[model samples]
Target chain A: MLLPWEYGVRNLARRPLRTMLTLAALSTVILLVFVVVGFIRGLEKSLSISGDRDVVLVYSVNSEENIENSAIAARTPALLAASVEGTQQRFGVTHVSPEMYLGTRVNTDENNGGLGLVRGVTTGAPLVRRSVKLIDGKWPSSGEVIVGQLAAAKLGYDKQDLAIGKQVVFENKTWEIVGQFAAGGAACESEIWCNLADLQTATKRQDLTVVALLLEPGSSTAEIELFCKERTDLELRALGETDYYQSLQQHYKPVRILAWLVVLLVSGAGVFAGLNMMYGAVAGRVREIATLQAIGYRRRAILLSIVQEGVLLAAAASLIAGAIALVLMNGLAIRFTMGAFTLRIDSVAVLFGCGIGLLLGVLGALPPAIKALRAKVAVSLKAV
Target chain B: MKTIANLSLVTAIVVLIGCKPSESKNENTKSSEPTGKQYLVASEPDDSTPVGEARKGAKDGDAVTLVGHIGGSTKPFVEGIAAFTIVDPKVAYCPPEEGCPTPWDYCCTQNEVKENIATVKIVNERGKTVSEDARQLLGVKELSLVVVQGTAKRDEQGNLSVMAQKVYVKQ
Candidate 1:
């Protein structure tokens, strides 16, 4: 016969201080699991949602992977719009955008400055980057700029510091923040965007960084690549936007592996902590366990009761940690090399965190409970 | 209650493992079998201009035979099409000590590559480029020396391309 469930629950209350300390320790470990898992999810989501399969990026062949280092002729966009068949078009306008991208020091004030991603784009940018939505104010004109929703967090500044009409200094020119935009949590949300002509004037550049164009439903990326091949003088390379972002995901594989390793290391450490605490708890209860065994309880029944106590404590800790993570870390914007993304405390993270907690409870209880039950019932009962 | 908790624990383990990002799948449409065997010649043309000289002199619709190593960019062959870029043989590959992973790209002489590379496409009677992959059609890979006999097509930008009628792959 099994021990009564109330027996396990009552044992938790018998030693209040030790129980509370164990709960706190378990909660802290589960919270760390929530954070690391959230980070991995956020980074993955940002990259996955950033690309549109129909859009293609045309940049200089020499630039290879880094779009910021790419330079193409200013007329390349016009040429591609005219030459490439099956491009999306409506009302005599083509879905092509010429952009200049760079990383530069952006200063909200004299004291607050950091490396910031900036993109200079034409009106046609919205045509190609369909995910981008202007959330506030109007589009930028000369000497004006627009900040992305997460740009403030990326630049380590308060939202008010980059509010509409506030000035930011970059490229040795002060630009008034005229608008705010969001790109469905894509990396662009961590950049500042401005007028292409204005940025060109400021940076003293005539070349473009890239030309992005959208293709019709049945269109293939091979056609655009063929155009690049045929016009070798242009020195351009075409890549599907989805493939481009997928490549970025591949580039960050090492970081994700390192994150998983951290999760393993943290879980390992938590297991050790749980074992140490359970050993102390079980050592104190040996005589009680012996008394129960003497009163016709099997060793299996006593062990189950001990495990039940541990699992109960862990379940409570999981709830506490999940609540704290949801409140404090969910949607918290964090800066990365590409840009910034929010920590996502979604259902997956919650499930993973709680799973770790329960696993800890089971694993932590087994060895100590087995050790205690192994002693002779007579010797245990006669112990001081 | 114990049974329920065990079940939930198993469910959580399955769900957490399933939480990984789904890999993006590439969709490729296989074209009909190509019948361009006549274009793949058995003998190399004796009078062939170097790809560098052909780029400067070849005109639209002019019959030409050009000889060069099959490479200019990292991906010399276009996907899903019987087309590839050939660079002038005179452009030397980077030495092994340079640690260049793709010497066929001629990264050390990019400017010369820009001037000497010519796109070769095998076209059907409809004047459309063949739908088959070049590697499968020509049996030639990157940096393979070959002779291409085709009609030159020059764009306004002075870029040269060949609508290939025949190709001789050097074994």
Candidate 2:
């Protein structure tokens, strides 16, 4: 009887075309699974980094994203400051900053047709959050505005762009571009900064909009929430800064779920391909497997050897897929809305994909591997 | 391109190191980062504290104290507690059918009076309803003995009105 390794080699050698086709098909499926996982990983990192851990984002209760839609009457910041029990704020524990989320069109004397998230903020904002960096010019004054990194790129504005100092007109009101900044790699990069009061006038909104605040030491979100409940006229929700961003993920859920659905469908196709190839490979190799059995090969040994070959083939294909994803997909930035983040092909995700592939290979190939061994030795020899 | 990548990597590390300190420091002191000193937990929670009562010491340019969140998107409600200025003797009126209410133009709803604050409804001596700016005139009497603050804007009609920022009950 041939040794176990000898039987595997002879079976694979006999159907070179089928073997190559199965490996290639499996490799493509693994590649797709890796890409989807990579995108999700990159997106999570981008969000956690974009909103600084130090800053608190206040939105109206029951409102998840689009704080413009989450407007708390301009007074919420201070009321929360006074009501949340056990919060520590000293030397003005409350830094009340109003924010307006207005996405509108603006231009430089022409239809530049650029989209912007114009945030109307007060001077107190600079003290509350430290992540907003002004690398050029100065902080926006009452009539002036600051541009985000992405906004600057879209407007062709540089650090020395004196056009910021010059009065530019839009929607009948004149505003000076005073400064530019980068808020990490977050969605804020598409934002425009202006004074809360001035923007109210420019937009003709006399009524105040939502407000944000920073709490000092010894503060808890639960106390603020309880305080909000007592003031039922104003619905309030207080959550930690990290917890808030996690909630923002719900904004991206519909699309992310669609992605996961696509991956599930594609992985089904891979399993189908795997089962078909495994059955065919076993059927075609019955003569060889029976011949080994004819020579006193144990049934368990025959089945185990065939299963190993199947897994090794899938693993090799998966490794190739991993290498491809790492080289071509890394740092491929996706422009989602006004902001963009790179698709990072993380190593841990590669291991996860390959592990899935190995599981599929074992489950799909085992039945076929056992069936071929179950065939009678005399019948197998006669066909050969 | 490679240099940009390297620079970004360094920056990320620096930022990472920077954020850890405050979290760790807070964790060490409070045994939890959730509560400590920034917020004053009331010895007993008081539902009677009008949002303004709790926030009497807020400095300039902060959000006015609100009883609760406004329910809708950008729903504009002149917060009664944060009135920037108070104007009294608003031209309130009883219904025109009520014989013009003896010539006082300002009147209060039962709900308003129960809250110890009346929403000022303004009407001319002839009993014509006016803009909400007239509502501020109602709070003037309520806060004359205390302090109230907010921004003031001229309405379509020229009138001095208060956008109440705060209302304090003076002892």
Candidate 3:
């Protein structure tokens, strides 16, 4: 084993040109794999943070952006909540918050104007969504509004300006700034919150737009969906947060899928380059490798040593790429048609990159290692 | 006592017959008057003017039926779509999502049964008459239509952009 590794090291070191080329090819592929995997995982995590595994997003079965568009007859929430006994299995009415939603404009009491989604929430909604944090100020009173942390920044309002007594306006209606809250780092940080009543009055939507339900813990997504399906009158649908994000991930699906395709193509190119480079290295290193085998090193041992070099090169590149992504990509928001979301960088993305690199290293090293091991000792010695 | 009951029944029948006009619930049952045939053609969006001159053409200061989304259609159709359909049923939100109408680039609504070209009317789950709020907040009333009036238009894609003016419910 030691003999083979010593030979492998000496052989790789002797053919500097070939070894460099192979390492370059392997490292480039490994680095790219690291970045792409991490990006997808990070984004998925950020999106998932906003959804509960059991919460169903009941939207117009017509309205794309407005609740008023496909107004579910206001009757649905209650019926779905209590209509069937089995629907609300353990603790009846675990959580139901009927709401009205609209994407509209809001002016921060600050200088620059801010435009974003103004969500009308009922008092009970906060209970259903416990992630909401009251950072400062009080709960929104009637005709009062609460701004998100980032929302405050967008409005040109400093954190100090988001005081409990500040005033904000929307749709020509003056709403007293009541309180502020943050939902960790999820997407909810970009909304203007007000009482459902005030939103109704301002938007002239006396009709509520959406019904959100947080199911009792421990219920499987299939079971919940089955229950929603059974009720015709209720006309409700349930999706796990992961499934919902995946469905919405359809928006980012192209990027995610394209990243893999890009990686695969690039990796293929790298593999070709590495194969040529490794073949040259194997041919050039015939003497050293043959000497090691002649001195009693097993073919498997030599193979393992060469493979280790490839793996180490790839892993190093992955670590470097993952670090770069963490530093540069984190919190960088990508603008979409109606809004923007920042990249969520986490430990998961880094680990994913490492895993990709490890796979690449193993796969990339195999062929060249085998070819070198198969070289006949007598011919290799004679050539050298 | 029996004679009094008999008198009350006769009076009640007479009153019911007299006040039937006030209790008429049907909107599309047709009026008794002679009028031009107004087809409930899918709420058409007309965009002959430039953006500077374009607006959700209101009829004599009244809300126009910008579009309608009927409920439970196998083929998804939002009213006033002359051409083009959203490839993905998601809306890109400008802001991070929060509260009830979490910000999204696009999203689907589950309000009232979409009744394309039907007059916008809101009804409760139990089929009762209630305020739009009681229905909206309670998730009882399905939106019959989403009507927008005098809103701006964006024709970036060369399709006529119609903002919702008033949602109509086909009663």
Ten contiguous residues minimizing lDDT sum, candidate 1 chain A: A264-273
Separate clash counts for every candidate: 0, 38, 67
Please write out the lDDT profile of model 3 over residues A15-126, one tens digit for every residue. Answer: 6776666666665665566555655665565566877666655655345333335566566666666643223333433466778766666665564465566778876677
Instruction: Kindly list the per-residue Cα lDDT of model 2 for residues A32-93, writing each as its tens digit.
Output: 88888777776776677765444556566546455556766766766666655454455754
Tens-digit per-residue lDDT, B54-92, candidate 3: 223322333333432222322222111111111111212
What does the lDDT read for residue A151 in candidate 1? 91
Chain B only: TM-score of model 2: 0.20
Per-model TM-score on C-alpha atoms: 0.89, 0.56, 0.51
Which candidate's DockQ is highest? 1
Q: DockQ of candidates 1 onward, in order?
A: 0.39, 0.02, 0.01
Error of model 3, residue A275, in angstroms: 4.1
Looking at candidate 3, what is the lDDT of residue A31? 58
The TM-score obtained for chain B by all candidates, in the order given, is 0.75, 0.20, 0.20
Measured over the true interface residues after superposition, the C-alpha RMSD of each candidate is 6.3, 16.4, 29.6
Q: Candidate 1, A200: how far from true, in Å?
A: 0.5
| Top lDDT hit | 1
Error of 1 at A219 (Å): 0.8
